[model samples]
Target: MLSEGWAKVYITVEGDSGDIERCCEKKDSHMEDLSLQYVNLEESENLERHRTEGFSSSKALVVRRGAPFRVSLQLEDRTFHPKTDFLRIKVMLGSLYVIIPVTSSKKVSSSSWNAYIDPEGLNLQSPSIFICSPASASVGCYRFQLCVFTQESQKAYAIGKFILLCNPWCREDAVYVPFEDQREEYVQNDSGLLFMGTPMNLVSRPWSFDQYEPGVLEACLNLLQVSPWHQKNTRLDYLNRNNPVYISRVVSAMINSEDDLGVLKGNWSDDFKQGVHPSMWTGSGDILKQWAQSGYSPVKYGQCWVFAAVMCTVMRVLGIPCRVVTNFNSAHDTNANLVIEEYYTETGQKLNVSKDSIWNFHVWVECYMTRRDLGPGMDGWQVLDPTPQERSGGEFCCGPAPVKAIKDRRIDLLYDIPFVYAEVNADVLSVIVSKGRVISYSKDTEKVGSLILTKAIGFPIHQSITGDYKHIKSPTSSLTSRRSTMSGDSTLSRAGSSNGVSVSLTLDRAQVAGEPVCFTVKVINRQNVAKKMKVHFNAQAKEYNHGPSDAFWETHGVIKLAPMEAKVVHQQILPAEYAHVLGDNLINLAVVVEDMDSQERVLASEEFNIASPHLTVQVADSIVPNKVQTASVSFTNPFSHPVSGVLTVAGAGLIQGKVNFRVLSLCPGGRMEQHITFVPSMVGTKMLQASLSLTNISSTIRGFKMVSVHGA
Candidate 1:
């Protein structure tokens, strides 16, 4: 932080340890002004050694335990004589403190703290010291103290303070990641993509994890400190911080304020006036800063993706390899029967008769670590959901459940494997109920766990990890499997066709906002005589996990299908009708064909998202770190009337909290261009994300550009 040797940094956040006040209490010295105590914290050099660049912007010295980082000891107006004086470093976290003596010989321990004078600075006026912490040391804010022992006097002074995190770069650490590239991508990369939309069409939303951004890292550390585990038993929480499994579970529970005072409060309704809308968030910096600034009040309006993305930021900040995963057609089997029941009326109205629901897409986080608790082969990527969908172990948290365990159906394992298993492998029962009586029903096996997606390493594309969570050939019901192999549409997962009459619903695959929504329903009759059927059609906009909001379109009519013939009916709803009711949510479309003569009805439905208009961000293909670069963002209002709001640009390792640009107004179909300059601080591939929030419509439009920062 200093142009000379090093600079002392002080930092504090909400829920920070009490010892920090003591560490920074005072610089009182036993000796006179002739010899003042000074410990220069070499943040840049130590950050490289500790693999803690993610928090470089933080005022606290962020370092991972189990690694040796360098610090310079400077005593004013004093000539150091190694034989006459001895130097020691005292580290304290809350009620726990340890004093490690500085020795000439290097000492490394997996169970205790150690330190030594750097060999290169042995003869220098300001000697550099290398401090080492045990791999099992508790992770949190620590007060650094220096004790100088001389023949004439002994003095201890508060020197500096730091935050300790899990050491993924240390082999002796439980969270150690062996591969360099994997660590760089998972733990170091502060920007990522969160997958959304239906399984048929995936939307990659860029997210700035903002680990290195100012104050974000402090907020993350504060989250761990204020957790229920830490609050209930500080000693136990400190001892358990070494394991990624424990840290992940704690983070999962702390990301959402369900039963505790965590970071985000979950909200799925249309209203988000108390705080920022979940969809408006393009980065974690603002949300985290708000939480820390608001005295740790849970930030309003967060859904699954928001929770998962913030959790990923926290996990990565703690040096755990983490990524976001999205499961399409994700089922929430509340009864644990692994069956999701969806009821429909004979007239094609969806009835919320069952507590179970299938989210069109659900987001969660996956952390990578050695699973020593679950035994061998159970390591690798594990699912840890921050969304408070259900309670596990008396807390509204889920996982630390291994993806391996989920895929192998090892529900007997620890940490809510059954719940995660049901999320991806549940069966759906499409039941047509009439007057409280089941008329016809069919089971769908391929619907759930249709796809599991994560952002690919070093690429913007999505990587399919569905096989990592479920078998390739998941078992299906006999009736459904028979129709599945009948060679119709390979991409479509359909059921209930074997009931002699087949019904299928298809939507215009390339549906977009500001355009007419179109779909077709095809009904086939295999019976010999003419089939007279009452056709029922309906559509409603719905949150991915919640029930439908208001109906956008519906119709009832009579139709006739000739023997052994199929009829297709096309339907379209203008943009004016649905534009008022859509924003990152999906449309639930369903139809029921009732055989009036036979008094039988069949149901078919599909869920799809309307893609929002894209904003374009242009930046140079290659950028130099520490050098200013200009980027332009252009957006054209797609909707009618004038729109106005704030446009925010943010990127971890590139920009600070958020760069805001005000937009007075833009007429319909009018383009707006904004150019901004920023200096990229860190190297490697970093994402520059821009988001436009429209206050008039309460909508957010997002765009991102990946820049390769090659130079130091």
Candidate 2:
């Protein structure tokens, strides 16, 4: 550790080939002629020191490329008198060396290493060594040596060796912003965003973004394949740094399969899964570090929210201002046509095949930057989706879509603005088909992109910014207009003409696992005469990526309705009937009503998900930065057989690295307890997350706890 107010010495020596041997000597030698000896160099003050059993010098020095660094040195019996002795500094990498001459300093500070000396010989102190790395500096470790020479010996003494490493986020090469608050939030890792569950509203829910882990930046660089000596061909290589092209490449590569180094390999399944909860991912740094340590294999199984949250970490670590955004009732406009179509059989069974569908919600990232590549109007927040939903430039990635362009409905803009635009503004059309022919149908124009949101900075609540993306139109206005347009002769002829009958369906309450599902079906007759109708009800549990797999239950009944009158029929499905096939605890129910007298059919359907109980993790006390705290986790095994696996705990500043606990055997229905002790190294809102995995059962349960850490 460097002492306060003490100046360090750094000497630079330059000479011919014959002088190299003299400077390389380890011991000090006294010569009759003028000579330099006792030269020593210490590692930079910021590098972490690891002391060995018998060694005092640092094992290595890690320095970020382009970061301003200082080194301290000392010389025995040799005083660097400005007028008499000439000092030279040689920076050596491999066999190459750059000779730098020592000159008088203009100004010096405690943190600076620039050479500074007094006029009087006795007042003169050691030379202050300051080095500013350029952006072109190759990243790697190098050795530096200092030498001194006099006119008589014509040789320089090599007194010391210093190790220097170049890292990615160097101070001199990265963009410099003027606002302290913005800089701290974007570059300093003070806060970050994490998404949980599915999106429920247009406004983003509050998620803690912790970016200040010690290895986070290093891990991020690893993602980009950036090292001290080599730069690999990643998405980052496609564009210039600090420009929109680079930003677009980064956003696209984040979720796309173009780069295997991408963090998320998306998988949506109830069983044979990994990472059950997005909140269990406490910070980007730890996640990235894990990937690096695992030999750069992409982290297993991530959905939209996970991809977006991790993207926020990488962007912020690279000094790019970023945040996570959520779109509620987001449409997956698979066909590039702003319409999501659903098909049903005459008996009300929903067909499993469709090119377009809508997701409950979708999460993406937005980065702030000046769009020098796109010219004046594009400077600001650009939408970027790490989710590999759509392809751009033959790769699975989206955006850098200018928010301004999205708001203005500039579907022609670069990237995937049209895809993103339809995510919020797409029209949904439900059509009924009988005998392979289209019949009655309805269109809901306001269903998709119902809400767009991001968390408000410095707040624990969601901030709705829907107005910034699209104007929310009245549902009635769009519905009436769409009905009129679809009621044209062409549409009516395509929809088999039948005696006027309308069918609608509604659920009694939210569906839950191990519980009955009850719903109501209503049939209305518009004809003057009474009519008989056949009603069919079917429930199927299907995977999100594929068509309906198996029918869980089915029922059909007959009903008679009076002229211009409506009749309601109620049905209940027991849990045992569908529980076996309920793959992610989700079921799609469809109901169809047919007028027996006219052979006309109407269909209605609904999809619901059942959520499982989550594990619980709690902190024992209030947390202060740099202070240790205890966290306890409790998990109850719901299985009937014994389970055993690993429980892993991780957080950005809460722990240095991931902590793992082993479970030998947990009895059926038994509760497992784990206590973890860690020290919070940063002050802010932080998250501590843990996951319990049972290899025997092939199940994983996750939980998280958020705490505010105050400065010590």
Candidate 3:
């Protein structure tokens, strides 16, 4: 039972009179001044022996709402005994506060603090306490004051002011059921995903969200447009506010392009023309902190991988279960026609007419939730894409598309299952056009969405679930009958070949900025007599949309091949030759072979990208909020001529304003370094993203450094 002195302090204030009375009472109390210390339970086994001051002066103690918290405290004055002394905790938020009387035993009461005080310690004057936040406690930051009152002294002393932040997680949110062995992995561990390059069977790189980092929950609340500390609305507002629709709407809007703070733009050429690697990113918390600190500006440049990774972080921080999945050979079926068409000229030069395109790989996030909105079997995993490519309900976002609906080809379902269905199952048509007429074309069903993958829970291995979505047979309805027939027949009849002569082309590897582009063309002659053929080769650089930009090199030659002979024609392009024509590091190369006597032609073409050097920024591993820090930006020229550019450095809490540096003449292969200094305004994970844009080259290279900041 609480003593009378502590009981008199537990008053429930409601109106203006209560506020006036509490203020007058605080001023009248002649309490002794004593320093309060917090015990470091994580670092020390004995709570009484290891203790530090509780305040912003040290790292904040973070815990989720409803989670048990243990804190051992010691008073500066050894005259106070824990057994006889009464302690009261006051939690203050703005003008309102809650008073809970600390007790030696756990007692059930609305105002009673259910805590256990251990008096038997190395220092008998110090006491270790166990406290638990009520399940209904709102998520936010609060200032708490602990005071001790002695019956002999008949006075209460103010010990210290501590900051307590309630995270967004509750027991109801921990409903994610993983496999028996993976139960601990999904709930307590972080997942991983690979990015940047072509999809491979390699293990995904590990990433930690570190949701416990200070200000993470607040930043997440900001993303959801919820006030962290103040509660104008109750938990029951809008079906508990944590419902699927509310969560989806918040996440969708936060990641979509309509809001720049969404962090990613689907347009690849705008920012990635110079070269940005998604794999280089550290983790989601780093990206989010950087965005939050930058005042919600889109983080320089990001593609599908970056969007998915950051979305995963936001969802996990909000107590939602999330995982990043990658689809290899993903099809962007812009028209919802269930077919992506590619056009090529007679000489195999790819035409830029078709809006459809196939990405080497595309990544997106899957969130686990029970969808009462859709009802029934749709209550499992829902797909959500942060990349703003398609518009959903006039907004640039996609999903909460139910995975079950996508697998069953239920395109009529809510959200954007149709778009996702095309991404994983669309047939790719390769068409050859000459003189405004279609000459030859072939459709390949297996090319797009070859393998759908996600990391195995608790394991560093690739898990293939391609068969799950691919098991459904082609739709036989009248609407899709013609298109389905075209796909089946096109596979049986290979286009671009006639008279038993076949031509094939292959690139040595993806071209780099300073390296030569080399490819081989193979032609088989099945005729009994010698044959004369004309070979036409062409190379051009084009934008990601397949729009032709410049024709770099073209040549024609005649070759005589004997009967039953197979000839391989090799072409090598020097760096100096294509450097001036390649605008965005992407090139479309084509090769064609013609049998002059029969007027038959065979064509082959390929598209590849060249890599550019990245602008690197280096800063300290850990930064202190409100303290000045210096960062260095390094850039290397990978071109033949001198490049002039502007380097811009910006961050949210790390810098006050954007910092810029101008380079007049950075010679090719020359390295340049610049330094910038700024003070951080808030504590948590911070990002310093820098970009260098060439004035003459129309290109931009970007890089970022993520650092943790301790509260001052």
Which candidate ranks first by TM-score, i.e. highest? 1
Cα lDDT of model 1 by residue, 1-712, tens digit:
3456455432222245433333223333454322434567888888777777656767778888888888886666776767656777778787677778888878577788998988764744678888888887777888877766565555566666888888877888877888888888888887889999876556789988887777888888889888889999998887788677888888899999998879999998768888877888888878888999999999997999999999999889887889999998899998999999988777666776689999988999999888888899998888999999889989999989989999999988988999999999999888888889999887887789888889888888888887788777745432234233322444246534645577877775557877787877778897877889898888888878887755678888888888888898888878887777767778888888888887777788877888877789999876998888999999998886788889899887788557999998899899999999999888878899998888777467889999889975
Model 2 TM: 0.69
Error of 1 at 246 (Å): 2.3
lDDT of 2 by residue, 143-162 (tens): 66555555444444343343
TM-score for each predicted model, relative to the true structure: 0.88, 0.69, 0.62
TM-score of 3: 0.62
Model 1, runs deviating above 4 Å: 1-3, 6-37, 75-87, 124-126, 150-154, 474-488, 557-559, 625-628, 637-646, 653-670, 679-684, 695-698, 710-712
Query: Between 1 and 2, whose TM-score is larger?
Result: 1
Least lDDT summed over 10 consecutive residues: which range in candidate 1?
478-487
Estimate the Cα RMSD of every predicted model relative to the unseen true structure.
5.4, 8.5, 9.9
Error of 1 at 448 (Å): 1.3
